[model samples]
Target: MKELIEVLVERKQKNASPLPYHGWVGPCTQVSLLYDGFRLGDASNYDSVKSFAQLMWPDGHPRFCKSMHTMATQIEELNKLIWLMIIDSYGLGEKWESVMINYKMLVQFMKYMAPPPGVYERGLFAHTDKPVSTIICDDQVLGLEVEVKDGQWIKLSLSPSSFCFVVGDPLRAWSNGRLKAVNHRIMMSGDNGRYSIAAFVIPIEGTIIKAPKELIDEQHPQLYKDFDFMEFFLFAFSDPAKHIDSGEQLHAFASLSPPISN
Candidate 1:
């Protein structure tokens, strides 16, 4: 991981050309490089792995490519295991394979530049992920923050080897709101740049996301209706107001109407 980050940073320093954007059904693959103040590069699907690697390192870095491929395989396996545990907990063990059939993993490499002297900048805005789950592996920089249920933000100080697993909107809906998606942001400060790799478990283009019957009962009512994952993903990016808060995005896109009482 350290070697990969070093190579990427070196490449970014040497190259000043603008990165090309690639369009997909959703926002995950929209921009290969997202440059506002910081840099964020994404490689999704199998074909994109090599393509993005070549784009970043034009001359080709064999070791970097190999490391990314290996890390992606490991993350993919971990995603499967995590979903298995989640489904079993919700009594949907038998549906695990079917549920995962339309899902794929996306790997993102992010580099947050150091803030200006005596000023802290928001590297990334606070928003919930649109995927099922995301696993983040960060360097020894303390900038990642998560908002808890009490409306307080907690900054995460993580070791280079530690991984943070975060739930996303899709997982929250699939579990009938049993699991709450995390709202997170990156706040950059200090003199050193922060680098992190994230593996996101995202659904394919037309996957219909809905909570299973086992997860919805009278005590636990269905919070979301059956909705196309891609549709909601696109809506989240297109709607101006929804872009501000992901909770609002989910509510606007797929929340079910409550039944009227006597």
Candidate 2:
């Protein structure tokens, strides 16, 4: 982990050019480089690798690409373990196994430039991830914050060896809203830049997200209707104004018809 962080930080210093693919999204102080496992073995991966190699490392440093690929594979394995835990805890192994096949993973490397002295900036705005789950390996710079149930934002102090696991909209909906999708953001402060890597586990395109029958009872009625995971993802990103920090976008996209009786 430390080696990967060092490599990314060194690359960032040596290359100030815009990122390939989704170049410089969100705040100007933040930039992201993404590697999607789903694109592997396809024409898209070939083109993406060519573009990334040319734009980021003109000299074609194979070590940088190797490091990223290695990290993505590690994170993919970790996500599988976490997913098994979730399935066992919720007893949705059978139902989930059928629909959740061919799950895709995305690894994102984020760099947040330090804000001006004594000023705090929103490097990435507050929002909930649209995937099933996300695992974040944050550096020691300490700018990640999460909103608690009481509406208080708590800054996380994580060590270099630590990893933060966060629930996302699809998982929350799959468990019949029993699992809460956390609202989180990167608050940039101080003079030191922040670096982090996030691995997101997403369902395959057109996977119908629905709660298993075992999780629904009189006490916990069906909260979300069956909806396409990719469709909801597109809906959430299509409109910036509709982006609510509390995961209301999921409700808006997949709430049950006529509402559930209280």
Say which candidate scores most in lDDT.
1
Summed over model 1, clashes come to 0
TM-score of each: 0.80, 0.78
Q: Which residue pairs clash in candidate 1? A: none
What candidate 2 gets wrong by more than 4 Å, as runs, is 1-26, 29-51, 93-96, 99-101, 240-246, 257-262
User: In model 1, what lDDT does residue 4 have?
Assistant: 41
Model 1 weakest lDDT span, ten residues long: 20-29
lDDT measured at residue 12 in model 1 versus the true structure, 0 to 100: 44
Give candidate 1 regions above 4 Å deviation.
Answer: 1-47, 240-244, 259-262
